[model samples]
Target chain A: MDSTVTTATNESVWGGGNQPLGASYGKLMMWFFLVSDALTFSGFLASYGFSRFKFIETWPIAELVFTHVPFFHGDYPLYYVAFMTFILIMSSVTMVLAVDAGHKMQQTRVIWYLFLTIIGGAIFVGSQAWEWSTFIRGDYGALETKGGRILQFVKADTGERAALADFAKNIPSEREDLQRDKGLWFQSEGYLTSRSVDEVVEGFVANPNILIRTETINDDNHKTVLTREESLKRIKDAAHVVEGANLIHNEYGSRLFADFFFFITGFHGFHVFSGVMINIIIFFNVILGTYERRGHYEMVEKIGLYWHFVDLVWVFVFTFFYLV
Target chain B: MAHAHKLEIFRGLLKFKTNVQKIWAVLVFLTIVTTIEVALGIIKPQALTHSHFLGMKVLNWIFITLTLVKAYYIAWDFMHLRDEKNSLRRAIVWTPIFLVLYLIFILLFEADYIYNVFKFGFVKWNF
Candidate 1:
């Protein structure tokens, strides 16, 4: 028998009903939205993957990029990001518990679990914002070559990264900031870099211990460091002093790395934020006894699907952006 | 609601005292998998990282596989996709699988072509 033939009614399986395929109308719609949303995310991640693969040699390794932990400043590599992922996955667990409580019509348990889930989401969102700021501010700066490659600095003896401020000679030079009152202010670029390419080049010449590390990754999966003579020649070819990541320049390695970092992680952060807001509304409804009056806590279950979808997306995001 | 599947995970690998216990079980599995992923990322064993399988590092393959496992548990148990009728499940899951896979395949291959152009063609290597 063909299930599509519902002879007794005008509504087909495609039409909305009490329960299509034994699932509520709202729940099914949520699934459809999630599937579409998943595709959107997939598009973003795949593009990021393409960019990473294209510049596989020059692309910044995720370990060196995400090496900052909150409240601790030395190289902590993947610790804080691990904590953030743990929080998000734990929130998914709490959300499932709330849905389970809803199934049993336990109002009190639902409230508590929902509360925990909201807290978990809030923490993840906050942590992501902090991470974005850290990345944008950057750490050790690099000089951009005429060919547009980034040349980083490292201690010759230790091969440890050296900060721009540690070696960049501050030459006293006055530059006027363009303002609305200034002529052609609209054409004005923002704040100038702390030091010019000439200044950094002079500084590099003065310091013999600092070596220039090229964006090219070697067989050992580390950036290629030039010899002292090559380092001098490389810095002389410097066209711009890039301090941190903006849309235009990135000191870490490839500028595309910064772009993908902002777009993909920002999209995920937005999802987590919206999921928290939806959970709050459902939390209020649970508290108001709305589901109890309806004799079913299906609303909670529906939102639980969205919440879990957010978590599932994060799993992929974490793997693609951070781990791989 | 008329739809409620038997509350169990892992094909009843270990019977739980209640649905709450089942929720905890899924949570534990996800945490353990994430821990392993993080540990691997940190240690990054040279053998796994250097070798390529299916055009990716074996370490990366492991991460992707673990992520999918976590996604499966979250979808099936937490979201109660298992409880839904087969038709609904297919409608929700199958629809995107086809479209997303198609888009990813085309775009990723195009990216590889572009990479080749940059590597061998007139586009300067640094730009």
Candidate 2:
């Protein structure tokens, strides 16, 4: 019975013969898993789109938000992300090469390609961690209004963004942070911002060259800058000084934007991390001649499929988050 | 046993001599597309931004189209879907493409409607 089931007879494929689709059980299952995984990612991206559309009028521009590089910094937008994109693509290339070499039963070539692919994935994941850190530690602080709108500052003369440290006054005041040990057991809060709202308002009033840029986008597709009088009036509505992005507050613009950024990118980064781990396991297997003993390297091919799926997801993430 | 790969891309308009060469060719194509995307994003030509096609900026449409092109090559070549049986390929590809399209369409349409309600309705925004 087992031999009959395993044998490929000349029967119609619709008769449920062996390997009807010409794919092994493991490979076919992997394809199905990938298809489902693709839908999950699409769901996240579509929800991101929904939130972006809901906040269309005040959606933060991706170029302005992601302008920082690691070492050299003077407003280089999209360069670091582009490099990351290249690295992921290069890793995908190496993964496919490993798979190809596996087909020819070339263990040494497979090992080298897998090693390169692992290095590339590590670099990409490290870059993502760095990007998240910078985003969490925002460059310029902003004011959050009672209505939860962000108000960034700009130099009236140059129209460049003004950091809170640049103009905030050194007003002497006693501000204490809530601590679990020092405060009520049930009431603990995060650390205080660098400067208080009163200090920021005073600094703005003292500096005549400062202007307030609202989150609202005007007809010219830029943030609406208020006049000096309007700036002063708007400053009074500020309830807190927001330094960076979190689930609740975002210095970039809408809180939902930061939420989606963290959720989607964090999810993708986790996928890369796992892919690297799986690749490392496969790398050791190749080094130990495990596939040679098995008389096949289909394991490498399976993992290659997974690694390529990761890169495929990144292509969409980069497009939706950065370019579009 | 090693299986043969479909070496040509772009509907057989271009062909490669070997599987390795085909993979490299696809990589070059992906890189070029990415470069174009980054350039267009940075440059953002005024004409493209000003013009609207199908309710989106022309630049965005270009980006999406190029993205799909890249995705096609990545799937067909890198994932070896091109070497799979037609039934297997369709099972893997068509299922997600159809479902994702439906999902995106319904969600985006509903989102646009909600945006209008927030924009013009009596309910205040960010409320």
Which candidate has the top score in DockQ? 1
Clashing pairs in 2: none
What lDDT does candidate 2 reach at residue A313? 94
List ranges where model 2 is wrong by over 4 Å.
A1-17, A177-182
Residue lDDT tens for model 2, A51-150: 8887788999999899999999789999999999999999999999999999999999999999999999999999999999999999999999999999
User: Local error of candidate 2 at A30, Å?
Assistant: 1.0
In candidate 1 chain A, where is summed lDDT lowest over 10 consecutive residues?
A1-10
What is the lDDT for A221 in model 1? 78
Across all candidates, the chain A TM-score values are 0.94, 0.94
Compose the digit string of candidate 2's lDDT tens values, residues B1-127: 2288889999999988899999998999999999999999999898998889988889999999999999999999999888887777887889999999998999888889989998889877552
* Consecutive 10-residue window with the lowest summed lDDT within model 1 chain B: B1-10
lDDT of 1 at B110: 79
Locate the minimum summed-lDDT window of 10 residues in model 2 chain A. A1-10
Residue-wise lDDT of candidate 1 within A1-324, one digit each (tens)? 214333345556565454536666787788889998998998899888878878777888888888899888698888898899899889988998888888888999999999999999999999999999998888888889888789999999999998877788878877776667777746765757777887788888999999999988898877899999999876777898888797778888898888888898999899999999999999999999999999999999888889989988988988988898
